[model samples]
Target: MSFRTALVLLTLLCALIWWQATRPVGAPATPSRSGITTSAASSRCPMPPRTERGAMPLQTDVPAGMSLQAIGETNLRPLAGFSIEARVLGREDYRIGHEADISPIDLALGWGRMTEDAVISQLDIRQSSRWYRYSWKDTPPIPVEEIVRSSANMHMIPADDAVAAALRRIERGQRVRVDGWLVEANTNNGWRWRSSLTREDSGGGACELVYVCSITRE
Candidate 1:
């Protein structure tokens, strides 16, 4: 091949890689029930009531047959599991397993009015594992603290390839339903991570460590 042709090919390759890395992702794939196992005979559990804080509604329901299972471990704790349904404010994927293969995507999730595009459009949101930041041009429609409390940065660990692929497809500004568990992990080296049961809190140790068995965009 001519040197010119080789150089052009290399340039194109570089551009493609950059695009892949920086392009915005779309919503998650359609829901698939193929691998999901849930109890149809049992009655559906009631959704949790909205908090008085007036934050966005985050309803967590423990379906009749739903239960927690162990997927990975840390030095001091074993990552337990739960189910969650919320709006995707933002998402960040890890190419390298910073916390090992146990977790991959850092999902910024919100619900209720926070899910409304009209409301969210006024604010700018960004997410990393267990951390999220927001900004707005004018005064926010709702209280900033309310938005923060209504949303959470979840460290998601897919239980299988199907769940992983579904998560990978999720993009910002999409609503998602996730079924799994809230887990805690501990390593002998003193490193530990755990899921926070409440959304009203923030800062260190507040992120949910989830082992996702099934996930779908709504």
Candidate 2:
């Protein structure tokens, strides 16, 4: 094309970009790197004045009629009804392995004293390879057993696309109530993964495998 024609097209493109850049919250949300469009521009997430000090996670018996649920070629069996209101200490996203095929995210959640900044600031918490780990500089802030009892790494299988989007937006330090089922996943190929039945244990096989229905940010 002619130089004048190209110049006019470039000007229009620049103007369009500028308009979208400064657009109001009502404007359409752009897609994330993963191609999921978020409503964060229209949604307000206010920071709480203080960390919510909530009780431990609540677990109950699996309700009647609960059975095998299919996800990504895997069948999930409800082991127990599980719910937790805790501070999000850390988050990890996965895109590989059988676990990622179903549960793509894991949250390092902390409750009780673990939720307090006074306690958290004294520790170094991290998550990877579907596990959560923590350490301290000199003396430990809390007993290792109490820390084990109060915090965990939870694999999250979002129940729907909306829940998946919400899970992606979760940030560190947000106190959120995650309501769902503790599940054991099995495949016809004989692959199996189960949720831990107790929070009083630590190390391998202690993480909870959750089928998340809803997450309420507090």
Candidate 3:
């Protein structure tokens, strides 16, 4: 190849790499899952009441092959045993400080008829460490208050490596069932982290700190 041609090609390659690295990530495509109905009428279904305490014991049938265990208090206080079957709205991974050693998966989960609504697709949802954020161009399908209460940003502390790996593999828009306990962690220096049992509130201290014992995709 001619020397001038080679120089031009190298410059183009550099530009391409730069563009690829600097480009923003576009919004994810709308998801379509079997048995999930995403119609405007479905949004009219009543929203679940706001919870102020821990989740009740599993009354619904547990998925086959799933195991349950009593999580005794170790260093953290096990406030309540909890479980939920919801859709994975968003996920964020962290790698810093004590949290780096355990509890890396932070999931924004949605349940009820909201799981099938196009509102989720219309909104740009994202999670950064323990925080969740969303934005939309047009009017939201449901009330913003209902959406806040229906979904939550949970900090999942996996009970084992296998469960952690499973949580890591969860994708956006997939249905996930999580079984665990709500806990509050305290450090020797007096720093502490606790889970919020209520879904009606927002801002600081509203996130659930869960020690997940089992996780599965539906």
Candidate 4:
């Protein structure tokens, strides 16, 4: 080829070689809308895994202010549609301090139900000095001990002989059913939840007894 033609040919070859060398190895990727790389894009729009919540089981701790029907059916199962019975299990007194005289006011207790509210109420009002018995321990157990004190506000209305005796039964481990209302109260401690039921189906009287009731499922 003539010098001029040869030069032109050489120039074309150089241009082709340079273009091939500068070409991208893989896909000439485009920027995402956010201008981040593909790896970053994958992370930004990552997939979320699946999750689930299991079936709710029956509970015994009656939520504070829950109705009697609600307590029996949900928290206290095996009691569906059955009227809850509250018996004044018994009266119990506990000594607060190491010495009898130094101890705080005696704690009367009656426990027939299984919620924080009921237990607190039972201990506050229905429970009396007589119902409390000392379990065998290293020595005579302290009365009104911290462990036995329940924080419930209960009314001390006069109860009939049968009703009073029923309270004793509860202290002795007898289980009695009660019919009443649900009240909610919050205190210095955490949530105090329970169910309260006065004895109904009898004549209209002041049978304002309380109980602490809870539920457990097998």
Candidate 5:
């Protein structure tokens, strides 16, 4: 190819890259375009009322999967319509990693008896490398089985910048209500990330992949 032609092509390529990098993923003003502002959060540990605590997340079946194409050729297939009011037991953010390309945050959430201060006080919670773990010195505070069923590590895929901002501001010990969908992402390159359909399971592959449409805090 001629040098002049190659230089022009290279300049166009650089311009395209810059535009893609600078574009907003979603703007706060246009949240309605993505979904409803259904989820929210607040700062720090003064717990929600008992009435707002202690309930299992609600998941509605989507018979056809409700698959939606997103992030290039990746198809985010909705496994169910999911909503949960729970305590933020832990929060982890990923900015530079393969997983961060899609889900940028992971929340360690607890509900049911796990939301009780009496129970929470007895446990030590920590999140690292996308895992949520809890422990208590001396005797166990509650049945290990109940703990397993009541808590989970969830991957959050913000539907828009509005959701992203809210999710980023969430703090541990705050009550959170998130409305969204359980999803499985499949890329054209055969990469896959799936959400666990059951809370009863634990260990690897147990985390929920949540595409958040709305979040609420405080």
Candidate 6:
């Protein structure tokens, strides 16, 4: 063949070979209507099914709320910036086991006493201008002489409506004892710990507000 013809033929052959080698193989005759569709993927390994629910999810980082009915003689440490005292009210079916999940009490009780041997409402304590008297007339006010002169002592500040009601009981001089978590008393943050407390006393059931106070036990 002539040199010019031979060179032309060789170029054509190379182009054809390159085109053929780059062509797709085993692909659908036509492009998929959905475009580049991919197959559903399976996980690399099988996962086990979830087993069960754990114990009640109350915060382990903070003290759990208790009720007056459950009060017993146990040594308790004074919470920083807070104080704790106990008085004998009565016995209660405190759920030492799965009581919360099973027979949950209508409310918690027995953390404080109105007197040396009485359980009073936590609400009453906060309400008593004599014992509490923090805010009045929209701004802080000096307590009257009777409150300052009275032997009544201070109790945990209510963190929520429930706690407020409990304190109110003490304010009214109703005998009450309540168990609760001790926390920094912030009016803004108190809602998280307030609880509606109920107790069967004086042959009748009563309901009131209680605050959850923090406690530490070994």
Candidate 1 to native Cα RMSD, angstroms: 13.5
* Candidate 4 minimal-lDDT segment of 10 residues: 39-48
User: Root-mean-square deviation of each candidate, in angstroms?
Assistant: 13.5, 9.7, 15.2, 28.0, 10.9, 26.3
Task: Give the per-residue lDDT of model 4 (tens digit) for 26-78.
Answer: 32223344453221111111111211122111113343433322221122111
Summarize candidate 6's per-residue lDDT along 1-218 as a digit string, tens digits: 89999999999999999999987432112222344221111111111121122211121222334222221221122122222232222222223532122222222223322233322322232322111222234322222332222222222332333333333333222223333332322223232222112122211112222223321110
Q: Write the per-residue lDDT of candidate 1 for residues 1-218, one digit (tens) a residue.
A: 99999999999999999999997443233424554322221111122333333243343544465444334444222233344567888888776754746787899988767777888889888775448878888699789788867777888876555566777778887666775556667666676677887778888878887766566664
Clash totals, every prediction? 14, 0, 0, 36, 9, 44
After the best TM-score superposition of candidate 1, give how far the Cα of residue 148 lies from its true spot, in angstroms: 2.4
Where does the lowest 10-residue lDDT sum fall in candidate 1? Answer: 38-47
Give me the runs in candidate 2 sitting further than 4 Å from their true place: 1-53
- TM-score, ranked from best to worst: 2, 5, 3, 1, 6, 4
Better of 3 and 5 by TM-score: 5
Q: Which ten residues in a row have the lowest lDDT in candidate 2?
A: 41-50
Write down the lDDT that model 3 would get.
Answer: 0.67
Task: Give the RMSD in angstroms, all C-alphas superposed, for model 4.
Answer: 28.0
Per-residue alpha-carbon lDDT of model 3 for 55-133, expressed as tens digits? 4223222234433232333256666666677888998888886754556778999876558657777888888857998
Candidate 5's displacement at residue 90, Å, is 0.4
lDDT-based ranking: 2, 5, 3, 1, 4, 6
lDDT (C-alpha, whole model) for all candidates: 0.65, 0.80, 0.67, 0.29, 0.79, 0.28
Alpha carbon deviation, residue 109, candidate 1 (Å): 0.7
lDDT of 5 at 123: 95
Task: Judge candidate 4 against the unseen true structure and give its global Cα lDDT, from 0 to 1.
Answer: 0.29
What lDDT tens digits, residue by residue, belong to model 5 across residues 1-218? 99999999999999999999997554343223335443332211111222223457887776552454486566788787777889999899998865798888999999889888999999999999889999999977999999999999999988766677878878888887777778899877898999999889999999999888767773
